[model samples]
Target: MGNEKDSLRAKLSPMSYHVTQENGTEPPFRNEYWDEERDGIYVDVISGKPLFSSLDKYDAGCGWPSFTKPIELEEIEELEDRSHLMVRTEVRSKKGEAHLGHVFNDGPKEAGGLRYCINSAALKFVSIEELEKEGYGQYKKLFS
Candidate 1:
């Protein structure tokens, strides 16, 4: 983990470092991807592991990017967070262990009744056009 942190420190921006490494949250509407409507996949910034897809994204009026579900359940790790005197589920990337964000129960029920309120700093977006070249060719079918 130390080596990974060292490498990530050199690659990530200050805001990314704070969000992903220090478990900090970016301001809701001011962050990236909150209103992104493009077709793509969101991956962990550090590990480049797929986390969410555009197909699962929706507007939750929370000022942050929200996904109904992840691309793969195994790609994320959910832990019980009791910070700020509140109980919440903290979502982290399984491989990178980056602090993605929290999950809430107040999502559209038809979509699964769960909202993965993720931080954009913890993720990198890969548009449909770049899926193949980015070694995510297998996921291209999802877009099709």
Candidate 2:
């Protein structure tokens, strides 16, 4: 386990390692993918598991990448978080066990009224053009 973790730590950037492994949070509006506007999908940085779709992404004004939904509900695992003197639902990647961020009831009502506020450091964006090459061809139809 130590060797695997060490290898993973070496593979990820300091911010990514901190967010996904140590459950750290990145500064809002200063992190990557916060304002990304493209047709693609996001996968877990640690395990490369499918997570969120760009089509569901929106600017929640929280300075993070917010999505109306995940690419697959089964891909995410939500837990009750009681930290920082508050109660919240923390979202994590099922496969990687990476700390994604949090979810809230405040979102576009028409979109199920849920907001998945995710950390950019925990995700790796796979653009539409690279979906097939990246072994995620099934998701290319999302852009069409």
lDDT of each: 0.93, 0.95
Across 6-77, the per-residue lDDT of candidate 2 in tens digits comes to 998899999999999988999999998999998899999988999999999999999999999999899999
For residues 28-140, write the lDDT of model 1, one tens digit per residue: 99988999999999999999999999999999999989999999999899999999999999999999878999999998899989999999999999999999999988989
Name the 10 consecutive residues with the lowest summed lDDT in model 1: 1-10
Best by TM-score: 2
Would you estimate the TM-scores of all the predictions?
Answer: 0.96, 0.98
Candidate 1: regions farther than 4 A off: 1-3
- Give stretches of model 2 more than 4 Å off: none
* Model 2 clash number: 0
Clashes of each: 0, 0
